[model samples]
Target: MLEILYYLQGHQSVYVGIVGAGIGALAAAIALRRARVAVTVLEAAGELLEIGAEIQMTPNVSVLLQRWDVADVIEDSLVQIEELNMRRKDGTLDGHTDIPVVEKALGRPWWLVHRAHLHEGIAVTAKRLGAAIHTNSRVVSLDHQAGGKVTFDLCRGADGLNSIVRSTLFPDVRPDAKTTNCAYRAVIPYERIRQDSIAKELIQKQTMEVWMGCNAYIITYPISAGELFNLVLSHHRPEKVYATQPDVPTEELRNEYKDFDPRIKCIVDMIHETSRWALLVTGPLKSWSSPQKNVVLMGDAAHSMVNHMAQGAATSMEDGAFLAKCIGAVVQGKLSLRKAITLYEVERMPKAFLKQQVSFLNGAIWRLAHGPKQQARDAAMAPDLEREYHVRSSNIYGDPQTVVDVYGYDVKVHAEEALEHFTNAEKDEYLGTGIVPGLEKYMGWFMKLPANQPHSKL
Candidate 1:
């Protein structure tokens, strides 16, 4: 018997409790509360900072965010770059995909939006919807109990990567990070990269372009409206990722990409300055929710894959929406937290795991580094990847149904389906409860391991 107010103190929500305040946080609060559940938000930092530049939102994520009514928040901050330029060594197009047609066919738009705006929008919306957002209030500790009573303290991992919450929940997975290469992340004024027609079209509208070269990969698109363009320029090297930020110099930015195309090189040269980090990633956490329905990891804390795929934030947000839908359905008597999270993992993990593979392929395409064997393999893959871009983009990529496969179904519809299974799955869930970790038991083999790794020096 916990006192509701005391429980409410330093916390909110009766159903989805003490969750990280990001996509998952908002989804839990908004979705659960909508179904008459109490939820609270806990953020280590106070106030949101829009740090990264343009992010690509695939149709699946957009489908969820639109239902959340926060799409406009991102829509305003985005420049929809529709064209994807696959520049050859000579800087000519190798192939192109029509963004408008893709969007029309998918029944959802592929968008490029500012990472910061999207963060703030979710933060603001969560607060408005009655989720307590503690900014600057770092989570100092976390303890997941056997009885499902998970607890934690704040003011830890507030400086970003050195997260206390991460250290607590995933001690084995905590970062003793290694730096492979350095990337300069910046959002230059539109005036810098907008001179050319292709670049100008990116600034003025929606288009996606990848500037590939022998030793580096620089991808840029519009975000924060046409006024700002986010650019990421990566150069590979052997260096140590300190337990702390290294004393990186601005000259390092210019020095790194000196050999790139004049346009991309200039974008780096004119960066005004740059921000850098040793890219870090962790293996998947297996599952997101804890047994008591009280705690879960979200956003970067859950999984931080390479930027090669361009779906990092989109994937995190999708997790948030799906998790939200899960908690909400359970509160509405449509399912249970255990079953809901199981279903959530069942649906979302496959997509992310697949994206990681596609991203590996895309990275190889950029470095022109796919080895001889892989070159032959890729020669075989071109038609399939292109076919995927053309045919599978509209429906979910897998499952039996053609009208809507597993991947493309609306999150709402999926939530309802999950609920149906939940009611019917009770005996199975009860019987299998000891046999597995809920719905995730069925997804054991769904995550296909990456077949190849990418290296710039290859």
Candidate 2:
């Protein structure tokens, strides 16, 4: 018993090197740890600093964290929002949806939380599960090999948008400048506006509010257990520039949303700091894996899309889960590493592309300035007192059933099915070899006697 324990401790079922230690990387690490595979996460940053950003954790993503046993660590830090409200720039209600109703159809509650807090939770889970995460160890290059011992390292590219792995894999694939948008992000402390009567009243009740205008829109929600407000504004911008700098002049931000709702402007004025990001689209990769099939891309590296659908992180989380499941199967000898990587791509690309389109459409709808087009959009989303009626009236992007379909996906089951398929193929190959080889000598002898074998004719 002691010898076996020592061996288990000394030997890893598989060695995996994951680049980038963000939500997706950490989640992938933890998922592999659950399968008892040794994982090392290499983050470019020297330390995991608190990025003052907030993200919406839809039911689809929350369910996966729960499955991975890290939900408790983040539950206290999450703001559970039950409602989603959309309004015209003047603050008139355009449409609304009940998050709880969507949650019921999806089987998990939607959460809003600080990006840093969620990262910490995933890091903690990864550590507890025995995955080693190395900070400041950026992988500038990759060296992959197949058919090696279990102890050999398998590279996984969980790197973010500007991924070196992705660039090296497909040089021709570039983000289309026409499809890009610019986002202004801010996370303001609730204390900044607690003194304002209207702002205070607004934050008292948990809700996600989206104010829409011509060619731009704003999404604001409570995060960090309602201690802060997360605001994001995306506008159609043609510049291909990518810049993230703090202390961006307030006037610049205000200029973008100058004609928005007064309340939204008021909230924007309260923001002391902000980051300007050029949101780049990275979906429909020619392939998410290397030709060798020894290295695979996950998360943003695989399919980076705009945040219009509030699914940037959610889809990455799904990528982590699916990739981990496939890699775990390889570690357990259920599938070859190459086969697993192929299955990962086959199972993920179409789904990611669909999500990419939905997100892009959402952005287009939200950014409609004014015209018959905008009017038709408003008419289609005509709200009703009944939640079900309102949801049914909304388009595919806003409909609750779309949420259910996207969130209800179970990648683990799909991974198992993929492994079973390959398993059957492998079995058939082995059986064919065994049966045919046994008849080799007889085949030769029978062929020699078959020149005129009328006696054997049926």
Candidate 3:
């Protein structure tokens, strides 16, 4: 039986076992290797095929990608988002935000890339950095016994929503609960979109368009270097849990949005097929690390939230970066493994949970019913649209503070500051309670916003 390995000063390398080869896992592998730790990624799938279509890499994650030397690898594949249009169901523009201006303010570019491209880029980098990736190596059980030859000094779960590592670590925590929402995701070739005059007009500029309606919304953006147009249609669905249907009939999708704007309907009709996914969310766990401190969870395994905020993947990558930073400090003898794990959990868990709540709240705001509340939301956003840059707006994306909090985050600085605070504190106080006193003082600006308190219904 393979036992968990341990690191020694100037001796054996620390072995990190990562389950699931998604973006988070690959990212962690890359960061850990850069920290001089040995990494082995176990992917249950026979191949590393990323299932999703497009993902928005907000500046927060884009910066990390650049730091990991991943941006250049996928440079040609990234489409920079220039503008964002918020519209009503009838395609009437309610507001507009200059994405470039927001990007400028954040000091990084906002990127839209196909999931496959991003995954390939990260995987390539991880492999080049000497991280071993083994597909078809499903981990059915974890042996914590420490007698035999050790294999991994640490284990991280980036296995996504149905993470086996999460289940093994926190069996009593309820599994992910299916939200009353579902999304149909599809991508149409730009060539195909250009054939439709109306659709072609919509894609003439590299912009992301969001059409909001009663209890539903549609988002479209050009991705894959403007070669393809990605569409995400989120709507209320009966409460039910089911497997994702990849080959969802296009007709069914068109029928669902038949009442939308002509341009939207035109684009929907062009989709030959799509995939339906049930939006699921995991409630906050008290701790992301196991009691042994050897096994830990990150990414979707720890805090799976709705995709409304488009931060799921971005935040997952942040987890990888921050976790690697903590572990790096341990390898450097600046901190112990126990303190590193504690700092990782304490510093990351609240922020991730807050993101989960905010994502749900953003969805609620976007899908407000056609009533006074919806009108108020649009009315509140109108003034910000008239300005060159947003100060604050009802639209979460346009809200200046929200934009900064989500996009301006720097994981390296955050980890360094957190490490400093942990190091300065009485070690016994933190290690005994697993709490970093006064850590909330360093929370992102959005943590104090009223919007952070999601509706009770959520």
Candidate 4:
């Protein structure tokens, strides 16, 4: 196996083993296959969640989805929102961005999908592409053997989130979820909400209507062939609690967002049940790879975030795609795994960490009162948030230039370049490596993508 690593460094023959089947694993399988690397995927869920909830796929995501031929698959089943309406705590229009038009301006479509459907779509595409998904199987512990092989402890922690894989890769960085508490999510039947003039108006409002209030926020959008509505509400409590087992009842759900507008009320009232879970954020780690094994952390296990900025799912998808490429390169003998992993961390850590922090702050601001900070946020996002009816629609489009730089990046570009750079060490494994890829030929893409150089600790 060690000889395989050396041969892999100079030749092209590598096989990849993945630990999870979420966005990261899916993307990894795609990328690895595209790069011609044999791959396998492992999952911890029984059946994929069929429950529906709205999800946003920014332009960065749109690019990859299109590239993978799954964009059409997802678009066929999701709603393309028209605009984004941001209102003050008192229900005054702060600013709005057009979603449908934004796609046109960016040359890509952004989609608002049912969460479960999106998962199914990805899993289906992955299966069709020959990627394996072993569910009802959990990875209990990781044994980093000497050869390029891994010993997984998959029998013990099989109940999903209490993942053995996560525990093994991040022993010292277990999630401290109590800080912010639960993020309340639910899908309301459209008929129940359409009865209200205001609610109906907002539903057909041709845009998203968001009401920011004291300690809570509610954003409404369409999903599930437009048969259902997607509602995401977040708030804070001194202690952590999940919505599925909330101390409060359905009646109390209305009181939580007490200050929201009437248009939002109809939808909230119609939410008979909510799928609530504790918001867990993992502490930063020194490495995403298990130095002692073949195990690697991906998705929420690596960078969990609140629902703010709607980047959690997107980020997870991006991780899967990038890992596939990285692992493919190593397995194919086109690059060294050690060198590839170094570039992976250098190029991925910064962006993922930023998204993590942004999700945290965005959620925090939403749960805050409608005073000074709200005023400041309204001023900052309004003008940049504005959208026209035809193009630059905030709902249907994204800042691709930004999303690509952050999420659309092809990690292989950097990995290869860093390896060839003269300053790159045979074993040093640092940014000093990026300099060797020859500035003229490959620097352009690196420069275009987000600058995810290593942190002092990463």
Q: Rate the local accuracy (lDDT) of all candidates.
A: 0.51, 0.68, 0.77, 0.57
Clashing pairs in 2: 214-369
Best by TM-score: 3
Q: Write the per-residue lDDT of candidate 1 for residues 342-455, one digit (tens) a residue.
A: 676566655555544444444544665434533332232233234343221111111112113222546566556655665676455622112112222112112222224221
Clashes of each: 25, 1, 1, 32
In model 4, where do residues sit more than 4 Å from their true spots?
Answer: 1-11, 44-52, 146-161, 242-248, 381-429, 432-458
Ranking according to lDDT, highest score first: 3, 2, 4, 1
lDDT tens per residue, model 4, 88-194: 54577865666655566557776777767777777777777776666666554544443335323111111124445556656666666746546677887778777
Question: What TM-score against the true fold does each predicted structure earn?
Answer: 0.73, 0.84, 0.90, 0.79
Candidate 4 TM-score versus the reference: 0.79
Writing each residue's lDDT as its tens digit, candidate 2 over 116-162 gives 88989999999989887777775565444434343333456666777
Winner of 3 and 4 under lDDT? 3
Tens-place lDDT digits, model 3, residues 60-125: 899988888899899999999778999988898877888888888788888999999999999999
lDDT of 2: 0.68
Report the candidate with higher lDDT, 1 versus 3: 3
The true-versus-predicted C-alpha distance at residue 188 of model 3, in Å, is: 0.6
